[model samples]
Structure formats: structure tokens, C-alpha cells
Target: MARTVRDANPDSRTARARLEPRGKPYFRNLEPGLHLGYRKAAKGAGKWVARHCTGEQAYEVETLATADDFSDPDGLAILSFRQAQERARERMVQRAHAAAGKTSPLTVRDALETYLDFLDANRKSGLDARHRAGAFIYPPLGEIEKLTTAKLDKWLTGLAKAPPRIRSKAGAEQRYRVIADDHELFRQQ
Candidate 1:
């Protein structure tokens, strides 16, 4: 068990900062940003305490009634270390994104909804956006994660190459290999 001591600055570039655990009551498998030890409660016997912090200033902790290392508040044992690490990592990512004025782990639905929600009936281009979203966006790339540009491009290209919705129509659907919607071609002019 190694114990380190240091203070963290909240507004610092936390992802690039070191994750050395600073201070106290260290126990088995201790690592930076994770500390588990025993503490005496005011009214009862001593209990185990788990502390985890990202490179940011705030520390989040969990208390255990007994000496059990992996028990949750429900008294059943759970994998605490891995879960805490993941949580810390996610928090760091989210914080960085927030600081940069961007959203993190953007779901496919969220990005789509943003444009759809922002479409104003007053603007001339707003209806075009809504049209693009409905007629071109949803059918192919339905509920995928919007985390990466590569993913969006790949999805769009794949959708463009996929078989058409309506196999054949009254009009010249034969010229187009990947029509977004074949029904659009058949509309009575």
C-alpha cells in the first residue's frame, strides 16, 4: 500500500495531471485516486471507508459498515474498484467536455433531437432542416451513438449505398441506385 500527499486544483487540466492518491488509512490494492481504510464512527464501532477522486478537487466517498472491502450500501458484495475507476474516468471526460463547451458521450438521438428541436417555423431554412432530418436522417442512422465523426460519415455512406425503401415506383426509380426515398419520385406533379 502506497500513500501520497498532494492538493488538487479544480480548474487545472485534470486529464493531463497526475492521479497520485494523497493521504491516509491505506489498505490492500490501493491506487491513485482510490483509498479504502477504517474509521471509527461516532455512535458505533469502526467501519471501512472508500474514497475516490478524479484529478479535480472534489472527492467522492462510500462507507462500509463492516470490514468488507467490496460491499455496497445494500449489503451485497460488488466490484467497487473497477466501477470507481470507470466512474472517475467518465467524470473526467465529462468535465473536460463541459469546460470546452461541448457535450460528451453524445447519443445519436440527442444530436438529431437538437436540430429538430431548434428548427424554428419562422426561419425559411428551418423547414429544410426538419425535412432533411425526417426524409434523410432517421431511417438509416436510427439510434446510433453520435460520439465520432467517422461513425457518422460511415453511417451516411452506408445508408446511401443500401437498398431503397420502395423497390420500384411509377417514375424513373431505375436510374437511382440508392434513392433516399423512392416514394418521393412517384408523387403526382
Candidate 2:
């Protein structure tokens, strides 16, 4: 495994200014196949770039943002060393997903929101399902891909153990203790 080393040469404006401008960019290896680069221009501000190895002999390059050389970093147009590194990682991940013919991975919240939108568009009466998912499932689940069968089983068990809340005509709330005989109700839920 190749370890990432810290270098101050490409990190600061003054340090970068001391180096002679050239066609090649100064690179910092983030990992075995990933590199963050600072392409210093002959005049004006330098730009941040990211390089990712796609194959044994193939590499892909992307320009990320402007380096914090002449002005303070705005995080959008200009970036500091750390910020540039983060942006490079994000860009590489996006590229990797695209190369694999996949969209960006969706979080649990995103999936739920999408489903709710679908329900609304179809004019389906899914208000209860939406409420239950938002209040219970949304709080517990994170990324859908990270969830395992065991975790889902545990969550279902917890849901079954909790008392059911009932509302009265007077707009009052009541909690009824969960009973073993009420398995049918939980199963339906």
C-alpha cells in the first residue's frame, strides 16, 4: 500500500510561488490510483486538478477548482488545499459511478422522498405509509445499500414491541400496550 505524504510545497501560495512555472503540474498522491494536482499557470491563479487511474495504462484527469493563490477560498470557485483534496475525492467518486453506468447512490431519505413524490403523482392514498416511514423507518435507516437483513429484522422486532398509539374523536391520544395476540396487527403494519 502507498502511504499519502504531507507536502507544504503545493499547499501554500508563497511556497507555490517560489517554484518555477512549467507545463507539468505538481502532484500529491492521495492513494495508489488517485492524485491531487495543482497546475500553476505562468500568469494569474493556478487551478486544482484530480487524476484517477482507470486502467493499467490509462488515467483520467479533471479540473476541480481554482487554487487559493491570489485570493481567499470561496469553496465554490476558489479552494484551499484541504478543500481541494475533498473536491477531488468527490469528483472521482462521481466519475467512477458514471463509468460504471450507475447514478449517484441514493440515501434512505432520498429514496423515501422519491417514493412520496411517486405516490402523490399517482394520486394514491399513501398518507399513512408516508407518515409511518418518515417517523419510524427514516430515523433508523441510513443508506439503503448499507442495510443488512439482520438489521431490518431487528428494526421490525423493535417496531412490534412498541405500543400502538390511538387517537380519539376529541383529538386526544392513547397508548395501548403491545400484546402477543396482536401479532396480526403488527404483521399488517
Candidate 3:
């Protein structure tokens, strides 16, 4: 004999309606600058619907719970997650432009000064000593404010004659070529 399966509730059907309370929820408890309403599915699942204002076009979001949930501590914490993502995206775009050598229309001297400031903030512990030695090896071509490619070439020539003194392990004078061939490549650019 075959057995027949019976419906758990033949009359059951999904219900749909606006889930927000009759009046507007308090402004302080809602996402600032935007109003959203919480909706509940027939199965009691929750979602969020954002609108420019009450009785305006609403955008449905599957993740957020009801307006009551917004009043809870955990809901407030979750709301900040979207805000934080927006801030991070803005910062990343700024950093990408800086890294691409796309500086503002600032003068070269001004750009160099800004770069120096960045170096100072992130300098290594021994950077000052290294810079002092490097300065002796490659003296400034002119007042950094009046620098030109020709003046820079003249300064490099001076280094070729008497490179900065490099001390040996025994503290003896050791002469080493400080000007690399590639030095001219940078000057040309």
C-alpha cells in the first residue's frame, strides 16, 4: 500500500507589508544624513531600506536588521563598518596619485622641500650620518634654489677629482670613486 504525504499547513502563504512603525523612528537612532527603514520578510528575516526621506524612493539592502536593531549597541557598531570603508577608499586614491609622481603644479624646489619633509618623518635612525657623508661626496651644485643641470654636472666633475674621504677599517685614508657612471643618466633626465 502507498502512503500519501500531507501538507504541514495548506493555507500558509507569505505576507508582505511595510515593516516600519506607524510614525517615523527617532532621527538620533538612524544612520546620519540618510533615513532607512527596516523590513521583515514573512519568515521574520530582516533587511534595510534607505530613502532620501520618508515617502521617497527606497533602496533595499539584504543585510541590516530592523530599526529596533539600530537602537542596540551591536547595530551601531555595524553601521560604522560602511563608513570606515568609504574613508579607506578615499585615502587609497590619494596615496596612488602621490606614488605615481603626479605632484601638484608646485615648483621643483617646492616639490623637493615637500619630499624632504616626508623623508624626515620616515627617516631611518642612521640617516643623518649617511646623509652627511653623502653630502661630502656630492656637494650641492648651487643654492638648491638656483640649481640647474649644467651646475649639477660641474659639481659631479669636482667629485671625480677628489671623492669624499672614506676611512678604512684601520682608520687610514682610502680613496674610492664616489661618482657612478649612472650619475650622468639622472642629470640628463
Query: What digit string (tens of lDDT, one per residue) describes model 3 on residues 40-74?
Result: 44444334444332234553222333323233324
Q: Which regions of candidate 2 fall more than 4 Å away from where they truly are? A: 1-8, 107-189
Candidate 2 lDDT tens digits, 1-189: 999975637988888888677767788998778899888899999989888998887988888999999999999999999999999888877877788666868677776777888887886757877877855788778557566789889989998877775543444544565455577876776
Best by lDDT: 2
Model 2 whole-model lDDT (C-alpha atoms): 0.81
Residue 47, candidate 1: C-alpha displacement in angstroms: 8.3
Superposition error at 37 for model 1 (Å): 11
CA error at residue 183 for candidate 2, angstroms: 17
For model 2, give the 10-residue run with minimal summed lDDT: 166-175
Candidate 3 minimal-lDDT segment of 10 residues = 7-16
lDDT for 15 (candidate 1): 18
Top TM-score prediction, candidate number: 2
Name the 10 consecutive residues with the lowest summed lDDT in model 1. Answer: 9-18
- Global CA lDDT of candidate 3, please? 0.42
Superposed by TM-score, candidate 1 places the C-alpha of residue 168 at a distance from the truth, in angstroms, of: 15
The local lDDT score (0 to 100) that residue 130 gets in candidate 3 is 43
Residue-level lDDT of model 1, residues 95-179, one tens digit each, is: 5577667774665666777766666734567777776676567766656664468877887798777665644454644443443
Q: Which is superior by lDDT, 2 or 3?
A: 2
Residue 28, model 3: Cα distance from true site in angstroms: 44
TM-score: model 3 vs. ground truth: 0.24
